[model samples]
Target: MKQLFVLATALLLAVSCSQNKAPKTLVLYYSQTNTTKAVAEEIANALGADLEAILPVVPYDGDMGATAARCAKDAAEGKLPELKPFTVDVAAYDVIFLGYPIWMGTYAPPVAAALEAVNLDGKKVVPFCTFGSGGLDTSVKDLQAKLPNTEILPGYGVRTARIDAAKAEVDYFLKSNGFLAGEVTPLPDFSEVRPATEADAAIFDAAVGTYPMIHAAATEVASRAVPGGIEYLFTAKDLPRDPAVEIPDHFIKVYVLAEDGKEPVFTQVLR
Candidate 1:
């Protein structure tokens, strides 16, 4: 009789503990041009999570060229911008949704400095970012390396040009990751790659032509159907800007979305 009572009490306590606790989430981000801030706010609103921005002691302002030069000088000196001290108790959060804008190829200097200041050990980290082209995968890898004990999950990234898509995309991202309650259709896999046809090349040209950084031509392509239309995965060969330079040509993977009744756009590029 005593054993039965003890077992019942233990089970009751276990049930109470399990049912009463919810993981606390915080949306922490640093935005240069407010693009990342928009994403951070959307996430916080959706999750009802705490929101905070990581600010640098010296704000990165001025023209793009000037900012780039300053960043470069800092990088060459191995210097990280001093971050303004965080007001929130970072240790209290169970899950941190870390967001940033990609600078050169990873999280901007302020984020790098924030990582140095905050100890995120044993916490679950979800990465999100805005970029000119693409850098989420690389930044996530960097975070994993820096915080070996932290659980880094799959991340969401959007191009600066596609900031307008963040709302619908963030909703889908949260739902798909089980962070929010909703149903999302799983995206289909791309079909096997084949040589690009004239139409495929035309679509690729129209998508990448505006980007000053890309001077490549599509060689092969594969595609799958998305919700609104189709998504293409193009294997492109970089065209030499200077024939006399004698640099070896390499391949890059580009993702382009052809939505219904709209011009196709390159969603992300994997170099």
Candidate 2:
């Protein structure tokens, strides 16, 4: 009877331990315009994980041109904006979904600050970003460099214009990575995207040389018209010779606008 009682007590303890296991997943993000926040919320809901935002001590001005200028200044100085105290306990989560907006071809400064705050050693860090025209490869490499001790996964990137259509892509990303289990919603056919025309190529070619970091020679891959401007995806060669910075060899997204007979200006560049 004594031995049987001891065995039962051990079994109960094992069950209790299993039930008291800590949550292994969390979604952490910093968003300026709510684009990254929308995607992060979807991911958190799908994975049933906890959600936390990195609040900056000084919030960004909502104006795009102003924000871009500020980001450029900070990037050139290699300075990260100060972030408010993070709410999540870094030690409690084993998997971190790090999401942010791509600012000047990299993670926003607040994300840089957040990376410094957390000890992500031994954690699996998955990144996702919202960009105007930039891809995920550059930002993923940057994140890996910052969190050398963590396992960084190949991330997901969505154009800010396509956030409404991101449900299927987000679902597939989570399931393929083993973060979620279940049926994935099918994506709508985007076959209607118009191809780049000769005129579009000319416009892109004329604007590419005007930018500093962009190469003069470019091949227009795709073009689409948005509300106020035309968006061009270009494969650029011989990028600006900057040894101190890491630039990815990939398609750069450029937006051009010419209104009221004004000279067409390259409004945005996503490298």
Residue pairs clashing in model 2 are: none
Write the residue-wise lDDT of candidate 1 on 97-216 in tens digits: 999998888888899898998889999999999999888888988889989999999999999999999999999999999999988999999999999999999999999977988888
- Computed on alpha carbons, the lDDT of every model, listed in order, comes to 0.93, 0.75
41: Cα error in model 2, Å: 0.6
Q: List model 2 lDDT by residue over 140-200, tens digit each.
A: 8888788888999878878776687578779888887667777654433222434556775
Question: In candidate 1, which residue pairs get closer than 3 Å at backbone N, Cα or C atoms, i.e. clash?
Answer: none
**TM-score of the candidate numbered 2?**
0.65
TM-score of each model, paired residue for residue: 0.95, 0.65
